[model samples]
Target: MLVAMALFALALERLIYWRVTHRRARRALIDAWIQRRDHVSWSALTLREVWTRELLARLRQPLPWLKLLVAVCPLLGLLGTVTGMIQVFDSLSLSDSGQARAMADGVARATLPTLVGMAVAVVGLLFVSRLEQIIRREDQRLHDRMARAVEDAHA
Candidate 1:
């Protein structure tokens, strides 16, 4: 369940990145800024700087939660490992005949969650890296677009 949740968050982040970086979305954002220019007391440059900062903040808002999930995955796996080991010890005490088989099964179960958690963390890390790149590129594009919009408004 935790793995599924992490994957879902990753997918959502990718979707958000795609939406934010799309040409149409970028244009719309700039257009909105242009519309608001006359209403605010701030100068065009100041407004642009504030808008850019806000945009980046909104884009990055979900990142910490996603990172938390990623970090938690391994700890959950460790918990599973501990529980499996406990079960193994319980079986060892209760059963004398099939001790080896029980221990082997328990060991396999113990390790599987760790493997799964690490795998999910790695996948989430990849998504986070790609999102970071997108954010950087979009930040530059937004700045350039806002500058042009300000220049046009001045002219």
Candidate 2:
């Protein structure tokens, strides 16, 4: 249940983040499309440097939440697991067949938290990896364009 909730939340948050970045990138791309043809000028150096920095800044915004969620999820799950184990041991001491069975059930349920934690971590890592990749790609593209523009201007 917790895993499913995390999945839903992760998807929603990521979608919102992507949309915002894509919107900004699209606007920049459109505005710079003409700049694309123009010879790389001295000004392109400043613009590329500044823009690259901003891109990296924006790319990092979503990470804290993802990282926190990933980190917290496992601990929460572990708590459930330990609690479940305690109940299991408690029941074993009572020597009641029914209580033992119930305790076993609690232990099984305890695993759900861990499962949710791992799931969240996996999902978060995937997002982190993809974000880094996009940031690198976009930065590289801007860098290349700047180089080309500068070269063209001198040529």
Candidate 3:
């Protein structure tokens, strides 16, 4: 749910940027963005600058959450395994049923949470890796454009 909302926000940001960038009033707006360079503003940058900023921003967002999720999975698995073993012990206290049968049921019951945790972790991992690469690419693009802008300024 959170991931989807983040993605939606990213999309909206892109849409807003694209809309503003294509407007005939871009020169005036960019001039404004430049003159207001108190602390947070970039002096004057290309459309590429804005695009790269958005991409890099989106890329870094999910990594911490993904790392935390991955770390939690193994803990949940261990917890499930421990509880399953406890159930086996409880079953062992009975004379009619064997410990093996109880152990099997316990293992099965515990596996569900482990699977869910691992699945969440895996999904996070996959997306985070992809985002990392994209962010790097965006950063590189920004650098290239900045370099060109610097060259133009020197000229």
Candidate 4:
């Protein structure tokens, strides 16, 4: 659970950072790319492609790991659940099986891990979805900006 939360925190921090810094980062990236250009052509499609490639390259660094972490969090919780159930079964096998109190306690213990795992999965899914939205919005903005740049250069 702690590991899952930590991963969520890291993902949220990066997503927020990107949201806050995107404009400056985009400008800097465009400037850098412009400087390295061997030829000049006001081709919006070409520029858009380059921007997409760059965006993918940048996002590739952290997005997959964030997704993996989010995905693993639920599995970890499931593992906990499985382990808890095993213990409950073991306890049941060793003792008087008719005690409602013992059975209830075991059931509670078994459910706690599953509940926690579900909660982590929900939280992780929220963060991952939000980050993907942010990335998609940024990509669209970059595409529009590149189109405008191409028009301005041609003019």
Candidate 5:
């Protein structure tokens, strides 16, 4: 479930980035904003800053959820570890003949989830890092373009 949520969030972020960065979509948004308000009083610097903030907020909307998922993964693994240990104890109390084998199997089960969870978290970190880089680059590009557009409109 954690892995599925992470994948979904990643995909959503990518989709948002693609839509936000698309030229036509951005142009249309700017055009609508212009149509709704007076552009004469809005300075290029102010408009640039506002657009930058807005776009950055939109880009980062999914980050908190992703971070939460990353945090929860290890916790879920810990839960699994606890359960496996319980199973180990239960098995130990059950029989004298296969005690060692049961304990070994339980240990394997316990450790596997921890390893898998940590691995998933590492991959999620990478994904988050890459998404951040993309957002930063796009923010800069959008700010420059908006600044130019605002300047041109004012002129």
Candidate 6:
């Protein structure tokens, strides 16, 4: 649950970075760099490539952790299920007669954790997919703008 929340927050932050807050900053940086005559040889394609790499790195930084956590959620659920089953088996062995209630309770406990884990994983994955899409679009846009900035500088 906590991991899922963190992933959601990361997705929101990325959305704000590209859609709300960073546009002006990006344009200003590009303009300032282009206006500097001394930096002409730095070249537009070169600048674009550098910025693309940096932005891509920043954009992709959280993805591996997000994927790992999402993947682990299911395993955690499975662990809960296994533990619950063990409890059920233990209760059965200890009781001379069948402990139907105890077994049922254990089964419920086992299933609940798996369900919770899967739920968290599903939610996390949804956010991850959206974040990736946004990142890809933003990356392309950044590349396009940087290419134009390079051309403007040369012009």
What TM-score, computed on C-alpha atoms, does each candidate reach? Answer: 0.79, 0.67, 0.52, 0.74, 0.74, 0.75
Model 5, TM vs. native: 0.74
Clashing pairs in 3: none
TM-score-best of 5 and 6: 6
> After superposing candidate 5, which stretches have Cα over 4 Å from the reference?
2-7, 10-13, 16-24, 29-42, 147-155
lDDT of 2 by residue, 4-97 (tens): 4764587567667667965577457435643555434667656656666776667666667666666776777788778777777776777756
The per-prediction tally of clashing pairs is: 0, 1, 0, 0, 0, 0
Candidate 3 residue-wise lDDT, 1-155, digit = tens: 34334443544454454345423233443344444434223544455366445545654654665566556665776677678667766666665766676567777886776676566567656655665675576577556655554455457
How far out, in Å, is residue 35 in model 3? 8.3
Model 2: which ten-residue window has the lowest total lDDT? 30-39
Candidate 4 residue 26 Cα shift, in angstroms, is 0.7
Candidate 4 versus truth, CA RMSD in Å, comes to 3.4
lDDT of model 1 at position 135? 80
lDDT tens per residue, model 1, 1-155: 65648666666865766685655656777988777646345586676777777777767767787777778888887888888888888878887776677789889988888887887778777777777787899899898887678678878
RMSD to true structure for each model, in Å: 3.5, 4.3, 7.5, 3.4, 3.7, 3.3
Off by over 4 Å in 6: 1-25, 33-42, 147-155
RMSD of 6: 3.3
* lDDT scores of the candidates, listed in order: 0.75, 0.66, 0.56, 0.71, 0.70, 0.75
Over 4 Å off in model 4, which ranges?
31-48, 149-155
* Model 2 regions more than 4 Å off: 1-11, 19-23, 29-44, 91-103, 145-155
